[model samples]
Target chain A: MKENYDIVIIGGGPAGLAAAVSAYDNGAKNILILEREPRLGGILNQCIHNGFGLTRFKESLSGPEYAYRFIKEVEARDIDVLLNTTVLSLEDNKTITAINSEYGVFSITPKAVILSMGCRERSRGALNIPGSRPAGIYSAGTAQKYVNIKGYLPGKRVVILGSGDIGLIMARRMTLEGAKVLAVCEIMPYSSGLRRNIEQCLNDFNIPLYLNHTITKIEGTSRVTGVVVSKVDENKQPIEGTEMHFDCDTVLFSVGLIPENELTKGAGIEQSRNTRGAVVYQNRETMIDGIFACGNVLQVHDLVDFVSEESEIAGACAANYVLNGRQEHNPISCINGDNISYVLPQKIDKNIPGNVKLFFRVRNTFKHCKIVVESNGVVLQEKKKLICVPGEMETVILSSDVIAKAEGDIVVRLEC
Target chain B: MNKQLTCIECPMGCLIEVEVENGAVKSVKGNTCLRGKMYAENEVICPLRVVTSTVKTVSGKMVSVKTDKPVRKSEIFEVMKKINSLTLDRNVVIGDVILANIDRDANLVATQNYND
Candidate 1:
């Protein structure tokens, strides 16, 4: 390990690997990737399902296969990778404090740092589900790890809650593993999972999906025995006399994902109120001079392809900041208008002189919608879509000419 | 008879309606792309899907594997049975064929590496 390096990426997942490769390609020869796992492919190792890399590779690939493509590149370029190393903190001066079993506590002051610690699933405790603390409850991702990586069956009968992508995928995965999947319950009318997953994972398997319903109570003393599900009203409160019961041994929670940004917050970096990650510019550089962030650590992405694209921006910009001091650029704030939940690259540097892709998601489901980007009532760009859902992400590219025409904050809105 | 299906060829999940006469696809409508049209026709005739799963290794670890191509959707369970019954005799690397000619020339290959 060197005392000083050009760039240090905190995670070894798809984002970290891609960022390191991009940094190296951009002339940052001395770069290091810190991965807490024993291997390079982070969450992808356990994500054994296909449907990854559709946009980036132009082919549908399994999670591990998509990650291996980048892992091979990183190995070919002779990039430095430190596995089984956990970064404890990031200081304000770009110093990283990390530790591993092989090496004791140590700190490295890098010229630039990239934060790629991905997000974590929201557990049952976070959901506030009233239930006895049983042994059969596991997060969808945790169950995925056990079944796909450890070769262990977590349970025999499963009932998934919250209809997220991971939960929907696990519904099919658990079913294929010879487990009886009774039902999948969602509190909202619409599912947060992608349309393909809902159709393929759940619909194909004949597993009943109950929308506008939630788990009212978990009835298990030692292990999971059953759960009481009830339909919820418009306000999300369970309606009386609308309860249904299922006999299942396990309950899987797929409520949502929370970005792992404690280190970013502890370092006193500016955080986005919506993304809960570091507020970054179009180049993915955070408010801190050389600290950049991308991937799930920046914003939870629906596809790994988008993660790779965002990390490349972070990696390239981090390299530029290290080689040439932060270049002079004027900042233009990008705001989320009506129906828009959140917009990435919260601020764009107009002087960057190129096209910048801004990714965002809608707050709800809409049909026949026009996504428009405008500034000071002047439309910059518009795209028509047949349908837009909160589960899938949408991107809009802003050319330099359109950006230059902005006299005030740029607004991205959905015009119905 | 007519059937409605969502075209999963790409992210644009277009709702396609297929006209069937005596179990044969007569026409595929409402699809925006050529791939979607093909998907609707095949779905009505015989659907196929890529199956991914993990097999037990000799070292007591699991190695993820997937079909080289889509297999008959109706035979997914049968193919999974073939996959679940096998225990690797030796360690294999990614892209190594675990089972060949599985359900219509689809090879089951390793997607993950397990080092003992």
Candidate 2:
């Protein structure tokens, strides 16, 4: 391992692999990718289901296949990858401390650093569901790894909690593997997962989806035996006299994902409350100079195609920072308006060349609405949409001319 | 017969209603794009799905594989049975055919490279 490099990307998942390839292609030859896993592909190795790379490859590919495409690109470029290495700390001075069996307690000072560490599943401890800590409970992704990677079934009868995409997919997977999936309960009225998953994974298998419901109590000892699901009111509080019991041996939690930002926090970098990640500019450069973040570490993207695209921006910009140095520009804040959950690239460089794409999500479902991008009471762009749901993300582009004409902060909102 | 279906072609998930008469799609409505319309028509007439699963290798490691093309939805379990019972004894790369003609016209190919 080299003591110095041009760029060091943490986390060798789809984001890290794409970033390394892009950085190499953009003339940053000396780059290294640090991966904690034994292999290059991160979570993609266990994601055996298809429906990936639709936008990027224009073909429905399984997770491993999608990852292999980028992995091959990185290999062709001869990028350096450190497997089974975990980064311990990231300092603001572009210094990374990592450890592995090959290199014990080493530090590398790269000219630029890119953080591609993805998100993690919300665990049972985070949910605080009143239940006994049983052996049959597992996160949806853990169950996926168990069945797809280890070739072991988690349980015979399963009741999945929270209708996230992983849970919905596992509903079909367990059923196909000959296990009986009892029910999928979601406390929210609307499922956070993609509508396509609900169709293919749950609807096709005739799995029951209980919306506005949550597990009120878990009844089990050494192993899971049953669960009491209760309906929630408009405020998401469980109501009385609406408990439904299901006899099952396992319970899978797929509530939500939180960006793994412990290293980001340790670096004292500015964080965004909306994305739970680092605050970055249009080029994905973070508040700290020469440091960048992309993929799930910047924002939890719905599709891997978008993750690759965003990581490319981060990679190219990191290369630019290494080669040409940081350019001087005024920063413009992008804020979420009414009904807008969050907008990314929280800050945009006013003097940036070309257009900037702002990705965002809606707070709730809206029909026949107009998405308006405005600055200082002047409408920059407006588009009509048939429907907008929180499940799917939305993107809008802002031309350089409109950005130059901005008088104050840019705001994105949904107007009915 | 009028049937309701959700277009899985994209993330939009437009709800499409299809009218079928005499085993043919009479009309498709509520799709926002051409792909959605085609999906609705094909779904109402004959539903098809691409099956993906993992097969055991000679070393007892799991290697991901998938159908090369969409097959009859009703034959998914049959295709899975064929995939489950087979194990690869030789090393394989992506796109290598693990089971030829697993279905009528679809081939089960390795989605990931496995060396055993």
Q: True contacts preserved, each candidate?
A: 0.60, 0.75
Residue A54 lDDT (model 1): 75
* lDDT of each residue in A1-416, candidate 2, tens digit only: 76679999999998998899899999899999999999997888888888899889887889999999999999898678999999999999978999999979899999999999999999999878897887999999999999999999999999999999999999999888889999999998899999999999998888999999999888898999999999999998999999999999999999999999999999999999999999999999999999999999899999989999999999998998899987896899999999999999999998668899999999999999999999988998998998898988899999898888888999999999
Off by over 4 Å in 1: none
CAPRI-wise, candidate 2 is medium
Q: What shift in Å separates residue B37 of candidate 1 from its native position after superposition?
A: 2.7
The 10-residue segment of model 2 chain A with minimum total lDDT is: A125-134
lDDT of 2 at A282: 96
Instruction: Report the C-alpha lDDT of model 2 over B23-92, residue by residue, as the tens digit.
Output: 9899999999888898898898789888989899889899999999888889888988998999889989
Q: Highest lDDT: which candidate?
A: 2
Residue pairs in clash, model 2: none
In candidate 1 chain A, what residue range of length 10 has the lowest lDDT sum? A123-132
C-alpha positional error of residue A43 in candidate 2 after TM-score superposition, expressed in Å: 1.6
